[model samples]
Target: MASLETRVTEFQENLARNSVNEIKEQIKEMQKMEESQNFVLKDCHEKTQNMLKRIVELEKTDFDDKFNHITRRMIGEVVREHLTPIQMNFNLENKSIKKLVEEHAYTIEQ
Candidate 1:
């Protein structure tokens, strides 16, 4: 029952509708891809954050270990320096006591 002009108009409207539907589908597909990209970026960001934290921890531990080693070495050197004279005095006193005891024993025997 439609004339040529009406049918032509209907054909144009259907073509426009189909084009709009294709555009909507393409937009949905693009949104899905963008969401997937966002998830990947978020995952990578978390991994990078964890790696930075681990690096900081490793640096701190290494620094603390080196500091402790240097401290212990310095303390050992100071202790050795302070104790050397005391050790020598103790050895001299021990020898003097032994000599005095030997002379006393000889006198007592005589």
Candidate 2:
């Protein structure tokens, strides 16, 4: 039969051991949760990087298309607004010069 003091000491030791075990279990649970959160964060980071890369590619394609459209429009406007009038006046001047030269040559020959 154990003395009263020895029984009290045994109870105290058992309580300490159970508290340690409970603390260990809590620590293991926390570590598992932390690992799961890290995995989720890594996956989210990868997805965000991919989305940013796709957006850059799309923006480059859109810029190229818009540049081409503006260039074509500017070329067409230059031809219509500046080149056509210059071409018509050149043709008229060429014909007048040719007629003057023929008239002078004929008079000189006579």
Q: TM-score for each prediction? A: 0.55, 0.54
* Candidate 2, lDDT over the whole model: 0.96
Poorly placed runs, candidate 1 (over 4 Å) = 63-110
Q: For candidate 1, give the lDDT of residue 55.
A: 93
Candidate 2 worst ten-residue window by lDDT: 56-65
Going through the candidates in order, what is the number of backbone clashes in each? 0, 0
lDDT of 2 by residue, 1-27 (tens): 999999999999999999999999999
lDDT on C-alpha atoms for all candidate structures: 0.98, 0.96
Which 10 successive residues of model 1 have the least lDDT summed?
A: 56-65
Q: In the order shown, what is each candidate's alpha-carbon RMSD?
A: 7.6, 9.5
